[model samples]
Target: MILCADIGGSFIDFAVVHPDGRTEHRRSVPTPLDNAPAFIGALVALCAPWPDMPLHIAIAGVECPDTGIIHAANIPCLQALPLAAHLHRETGRAVRIANDADCFALAEAHFGIAKGHRNVFGVILGTGIGGGFVLDGRIVPGLGGVTGEWGHAPVVIPPPVPLDQEAAETLVPLFRCGCGISGCLDTIAGARALERLHLWAGGTPQTSRAIFEAWQTGDRQAGRTLDIWLSYMGAGLAHVINVTGSTIVPVAGGLSNAHALVDALDEAVRARILTTTSGPLLRRAALGADAGLLGAACLGLDIRAQE
Candidate 1:
């Protein structure tokens, strides 16, 4: 068994996971964002009941593979901390850590929608965009332990010359991204960015949920916003697929709940990619909230395999 925890900005979700992906003793506790000692203590307390099990964490941050230092934007206490080492010392148990996005991909590859696939890319389309690449049932390692950050780099291309005059009106502005880069897909691809795009497209302020609802009901403005959204998002994903040669993509996050939207995006991506497959490459993630814990379990299991 592995003691697994999914550490988010707001909560630390804990569970004991069996090798087959069954989770038990699940619970959650408030995350101590500013106090490092408190953060350590919370995890220690959670692990106390299972004395011998190794602890594995899936966090909303990056851990440098060379230095072991963690950079979590939301959890200030963990910034620059070698979390696994510190936790192992405090709790007297071996510990492993991975980015939540990577963990999500690992879980999907091993036990979720991409179960049979050898190469899988898992995407998160929430408040911000994130992704993880899994090759041969493991999360592919890279410099700074960040392999699948497909959203950060600039990807927006200039809108093609309109075939007709009316098409010119739909061209989106190249907005600056939070990463301090201009024209990144992140500038216009995330949930919040989608709202910004909607406003720029001449629609009144509305939540992403409302926009999807409107689009499904055939709202012209909403449809127009999503048409542009699908075009860019699909193009970005096509680049990822082409480069990775992934046979499957499992999508998670708030936007993916819109089944029709995911279907539309899948169609767009298939149209753009070079390979011709008979079936869709993108599938809705099956693991849901349990992905993190199960993924942490996979991490622990990998460690055990090495030992």
Candidate 2:
């Protein structure tokens, strides 16, 4: 069995996962963001009863493959820390870590919607955009452990032609991103970004869910906001699809719950991409919240296989 932990900014979901992918003894605990020792202590305490078992982690951050240093923006204490090594030393057991998005992708590829696909991209459209790429049933190793982070790149530049009235009226700004970049798709995509984009398009302040609901109900204001959203989101995804040659794109996170919205995105992406298949390219995530922990288990299983 592998001890798996899905560490997020706010909580840590812990479980014991069997080799066949069944999980047990699952628990959730509030994360200690400000204290590194507390973070390690939390993991140690969670897995203490199952001594000698390997621990695997899916974290909401990047771990540099070369240096083992973590870059977790949400959990400040983990920044620059060698989290896997620290945990292993503290718990006296082997430990492994991967970005949560990558873990989600790996889980999808192995056990979820992208099963049997050689190339897959699992995208998370939540508070902000994130993704992970899987090739040949394995997560691709990345420089600075930052593969499949397509959300941060600046893809939307203002068109040169005279803008339509809605476009002119919206005047979407090149909002700065947490990654220290401007004009990034992240600034305009995802949940909070969607709300921001909605307001920019002259709509009243509302949650992304409300906006999606309004759009579904044929509200003109929400419809216009979503139109702008689909345009940029679809174009960005099309570029990713073309470049990755991924046969399937499994989407997770809050936005993925909007089936119609995902369907609309699929339509937009299909219309823009070079591929001409009649089937839908984007699929809803099968694993949902369990994806991260499952992927962490999968990561441990993969490492054990290599040994």
User: What is the per-residue lDDT of model 1 for residues 23-78, given as tens digits with 9 covering 90 to 100?
Assistant: 88998999999999999999999999988878999999999998899989899998
lDDT of 2 by residue, 1-307 (tens): 8899999999999999987779999999999999998998899999999998888999999998888999998999988799888887777898889999999999999889999999899899999999999998889988878999889877755667988887765566778888888878898899999999999888999999999999999999999999989999899999999998999999999899999999999999999999897699899999989999999999988998899
For all candidates, what are the clash counts?
A: 0, 0
Each candidate structure's TM-score, on Cα atoms with residue i matched to residue i, is: 0.94, 0.94
RMSD over all Cα atoms, model 2: 2.2
Predicted structure 1: clash tally: 0
Q: Model 1, residue 204: what's the lDDT?
A: 96
Report how far off residue 222 is in candidate 2 (Å).
1.5
* Regions of model 1 farther than 4 Å from truth: 157-171
* Error at 188, model 2, angstroms: 1.2
Worst ten in a row by lDDT for model 1: 161-170
Candidate 1 local lDDT, residue 182: 85
Stretches > 4 Å off in candidate 2: 158-171
Q: CA shift at 201, candidate 1, in angstroms?
A: 1.3
